[model samples]
Target: MTITRRDFLNGTALTIAAGLAPTSVLRAAEAQGPAYPPALTGLRGNHPGTFTLAHSLAREGAKYPGVLARESYDLVVVGGGIGGLAAAWFYQQRFGGNARILILDNHDDFGGHAKRNEFTVRGRTLVTYGGSAEMPPSANDNAAVRALLAGLDLAPRIQARPGDDYARRGLGRAVFFDAEHFGRDQWLAGDPFAALVDARNAGVRPAPEDLGAFLNAAPLPPADRQALQRLAQGETDYLSGMAGEARARYAQSTRYAVFLREKAGLGLPGLRFLRSRSQDAYALDADGITVAQAISIGLPAGAGMAAPAIDPRLGKSPASRLWFPDGNATLARALASKLVPGVAAAQGQEIVGARFDYSKLDREGNPVRIRLNSTAIAIEPDVRITRVTYGWQGNLQRVEAAHVVVAGYDMMVPFILPSLPVPAKAALRACVKAPLVYTKVALDNWRAFDALKTWRIHAPTMAYSDLWLESAPGGKDDPVVLHMLYVPTVPDSGMSARERFRAGRAFLLGTPFEVLERDIRAQLDRMLAAGGFKSARDIQGITVNRWAHGYSYMPSGLAPDDANLQVALEQAGRGVGNIRIAGADTAGSPSVTAAIEQSMRAVGSLNPKT
Candidate 1:
């Protein structure tokens, strides 16, 4: 009996309602002596309950029938992602811990994208972020985010020693050219960040000439190789006809693909090589993104020329030095623990090792209650109090609150609170998130990676853009998880950025898990065959945390008057009748820093005396 991704997502909702621990279920399955690649192991984010609830609220378009129970609170927050969790913490900060609050999230887990993917293989425990991995250093400057971490005693920083150690183990960067793009499966040992020399470790610099050799060795025809050679050199003035200011303007205004085709003469093959780079960073394709944005992130021939400040080798200081083992999930965990004491150990960043008592999350008489697998269906703001109707345990439940923070996905806000003003709704709709998929593939051993002489591989023409070996907390051999990132996008010749995102979201949600798994297995085998990697033989388990609607929208630099656009969004989210809007949407960016800021805004909108 094979369970599809959709089936598995739906199945988990039932399991959550039954109060069954997913860990116990996994242990029970492991007790059966591991069925090889294992049964039903894909699509792990936006769990079944969350998916169904959002779908029901959106597509169903009907009022939730017959309230199961009625409750009241001083504050009711919708969605339990980082933003909502922070909102709960902020309420505690502003109104004291005595404030009665309830956080309703559709997912079985409360961390939202801050969820975790834990696996135990051969008496070894391997943990990876299910979603919302890594915190930017700028987050440290965010007093709220920093204060929360401080309260939890979590000092977020990457253990560069482990990563450096891993790099020394016959490991480096590699690029994969799928047959669709390059006419054959080819892996080249080279650093993709060759142009931004400083981005690589201090001693791990690959010279331009060395990278040229790697490109020349690609299984491309002579002409293609020559074109690639020129691209690698970065000395070619490909904009020959358009010189000086014209060239500068062309570089800034022209789409990278056009610059590549018309100016650089990269042809179809050369362009394909650079296509994945854009999608991996922003969800935009070559056609959709401007050459300016492309250069800012580093790509094409003149990327470093335009953006010297981004060059890591030039001693350019990064925004911050804050990132955790499980990304921002650690922050989410910290916030949850603060809101619900004893839910997680009060220990520092090592909270990953602490087991959360979910049963205690929504215990009676607690000032703060986080109810998992509960979805907010509707919110009605009145003069005195806001009424929120949510679904929990397959029943519609109503909760009234003096203040309601609708801090879920921005797009869902209009649907959940239909009476919102038209302009605000339009502004909310514009906050569409970029869909992303992050997969963790556990392997029995990592000898294949060593044999291949690469730790990371980027596939421009495949479903997955890049994959690399993820390090566990403690350095050990034999068992490891290969983390792969997939941004579901295919260039639509005639679609706006938002339209393309919608199409990509549909494509991602509609696609089955088996297809994704097959691609993962096949791509791994093709890339690592030289090192003796057979997917079925060495693959232990795969957890695909599919966030069909991922990163929050931040207006493109090319977009007109970024300040005004944000002002419009902020005005739109000002909330009607105490139904204050919050989350990354109101922040006009998907960053955790913005989420925390919006959380403060949402709580601040109410009377401080309340």
Candidate 2:
């Protein structure tokens, strides 16, 4: 039976007042203080009241008559995401600091998917990322990305923290077998899947001896256990008879699951165990990933056959990547600070800890204003100026700009700009986003994790596939934040990647907060019960950052590359008169660097002679 919110609250020893709504819990705490977006826990990311107008315009064909144009700007950027923010910065740089620019976003907070979640437990403030978490080495390689980082006084590279804390505490990676799939609750101490990826990193190494014991302890049938043991041992070359080029071709064309079943000899149980391994990177299961793609990402294929090396362009070392306490939200905050002077008052890493003054974001006389909770409904381009109409407050507001940058979702662009060509609209509609959830649970203490002797747990069949502590607790009583990931992909469903993404998106938006909360609590309680973890007593706060339209979809390697689709994506990003498109989706890459690069390209396209 589905657990209700009342049942959950009644069962737990929650510190918050009874009957207080989850959405208002944080707001009530900040009644006497300045409103802070990061600290407002529960139902964030694509929060309610943020998407109503957009949904109405897209789904119901609702029209908003343009009100009298109340404001004019040199540039009006739709969507206050990284792309839009970067576009504003680039425009100001190109047109001088005096250029009047405005950025409009539907969400109450800026940064879009680059969201920051903050919590206060036991009088201590903790920071965690709700979305857009890492700056990989490839991001720094882009000159535009590097320039943006340099302007913010931020370093592209961060020194990896010395030593593995989990190892030091006698804890390691683990796998939790849920009753739904395994028929019983079982926790295995060592995870072979994680070790496969971790082995590629130079910073830490897993002991080879643990693999045998871990695999044997798994609740798999004897045949499945034997198959997994063979794959882990990496002694047999599944593609032994083929030449190098033929092997490469086969790997690219064949699915990873197909390879395991046909060549590696894995049965149903083994296939299920390995399904969600690829979800963290591609948001797809083993059935969706190509054998070549799987090997390149450090998934075990056949160690006997020279495994295809990780793409050098993507960067192989984990240490080369940089991250802030609140993920790439640091980059967003840095951009906002540069664009709007008083949004944040710190520099360098201090920016991560700085509390943003939301009031200063859209001041009367500011050259660059970021107006949040303003949803753009229409964008009509004229010979000179473009008329932009947005739903704000209780009425439709109009604004005119010399040039408009369409930096929001490519899919929504077709709805907003109905004047676009049929082909362009089709291309825009094709950019389906992968649906996922990044949940942050503020805990009273992480003694349970220490007791379990596992900092990370991978549960293939559970609601959340992956869960890990943001960092090791300093003491048994120290409060901590646990991060969880859920990707709603229907693998082996005979649907195309885009179709699966759309299905996942629908499922995410349809599921309520209470259901998500219940699943999280139940999963945690089941996984950590042996460690003396009780969700009611330990979980202090939960911020469910549901990205129904999450990661910008890219080809998942299950299907052959389509040239027509590539051309369509390119055409989608092309400028139409005074309107220029810029976003990760438009750029055809789901990275901060690509978004910034697209923004720069879009800005450069505007008024070239100037």
Query: Among these predicted structures, which one has the highest lDDT?
Result: 2
In model 1, the number of clashes is: 5
Each candidate's root-mean-square deviation in Å?
6.8, 6.4
CA deviation > 4 Å runs, candidate 2: 1-34, 157-163, 200-209, 303-320, 608-610
TM-scores of all models?
Answer: 0.86, 0.90
Q: Which regions of candidate 1 deviate over 4 angstroms?
A: 1-41, 66-69, 161-163, 192-206, 222-224, 236-253, 300-305, 308-322, 472-477, 492-494, 557-564
lDDT for model 1 comes to: 0.68
Error of 2 at 527 (Å): 0.9
* Residue-level error in angstroms, candidate 1, position 474: 7.4
| Model number with the top TM-score | 2
